[model samples]
Target: MENGIIYNSNLHFEHQRWKGELAFWKDELKFFNNRLSELVTRWTNKDVLAQLEHYQNEFVLHNEVIEEMLEDIEEHETRIAGQSKTGADALDTQMVKKHLEFRNRLETQRHIYSELKKEFFRFLEKYM
Candidate 1:
């Protein structure tokens, strides 16, 4: 799966990048939940609404990133299919191979994010 670009190094980088992103979002989600809980405890904290709105916006941005990644993967797959029918040359073959590897990595990351998202919401729902 390394495509030979320093094989294990690239694979390790991909794994680290994926896990780092997952860790970031997981932390942000937890921070929002905790802040919301703290705000709920105070009687006169009326500005916490803005913080929640910020969290919502951040969530949307992250969601968009995921959606765009999915769309890109789909686009690559379609391109690969079309290129094959057209007797793709060397460059096209290389592009398709790269796309397939990327899609595989992104899909794996997506699955990890999904499970983390579910856990985040489940915990927040308990407080809500």
Candidate 2:
């Protein structure tokens, strides 16, 4: 049997939620970047400096990814709004597929961010 359809309203809510999560992550990355700056100024150990630089680069990359994701989410939300104006009760199969893809990407990013966060804390505890 074919999978059932999803409501546009539901997708809209989900997109909003995803945007909120991304915003929170962006703020967290900013905070981490700030902390890394402080750590960099205080430490001169070669190994620690290397690790700190790595984190600094990672945070910048993560922030860029978050910005891209936010843009994608905004576009998706716009498409959903357009679809809703047509009085459609269910999203198209293609839209549903895109939704799943977006969700998967978000999950993967979250996992990577979580691991990086843990590793960063461990580094802090070990060096600081």
Candidate 3:
């Protein structure tokens, strides 16, 4: 953001970067799900199976959150594009605020997801 104004080019780049990160997370989640499936199949202990089920539910919920965030990002990008006065115009204060809010939400999601990933890996090490 330059002088509280976000240029169109900058916004586009930021949006693309965030979208790419989200896509990678989605793919990683799928891989994690596959691993969980394998563990669930091999494990027979009731306690271990229950923990696997818990992780499955968490991953599913995180997937939904990722999808929702992607949709919201698309809508925000569309809105920004629609409001652009010129190809290289800058966003207004309100748009800047909105973009910052999105950035914060994205960071929060990333942090939470990272923690979840670490927890899952620890479980795998202990049980798998």
lDDT of 3 by residue, 45-122 (tens): 999999999999999999999999899888878877787755648877787788889899999999999999999999
* TM-score ranking, high to low: 2, 3, 1
Question: What is candidate 1's lDDT per residue for 51-85, written digit by digit as tens?
Answer: 44555565666666665664554565455456556
- In order, what lDDT does every prediction score? 0.56, 0.88, 0.88
- Give model 1's TM-score versus the native structure: 0.42
Candidate 2 lDDT for residue 11: 86
| Model 2 C-alpha lDDT per residue in residues 1-128, reported as the tens digit of each score | 13565888788889889999999998898888888888888999998899999999999899999999999988888888898888986888998899899999999999999999999999888876
Q: Per-candidate RMSD vs. true structure?
A: 9.3, 2.2, 1.6
Better TM-score candidate (1, 3): 3
The better-scoring model by TM-score among 1 and 2 is 2
lDDT of 1 at 100: 56
lDDT of 3 at 64: 95
Among all candidates shown, the one with the greatest TM-score: 2
Q: Candidate 2, after superposition: displacement of residue 70 in Å?
A: 0.8
- Model 3: how far residue 96 lies from native, Å: 1.5
Tell me each candidate's TM-score: 0.42, 0.92, 0.92
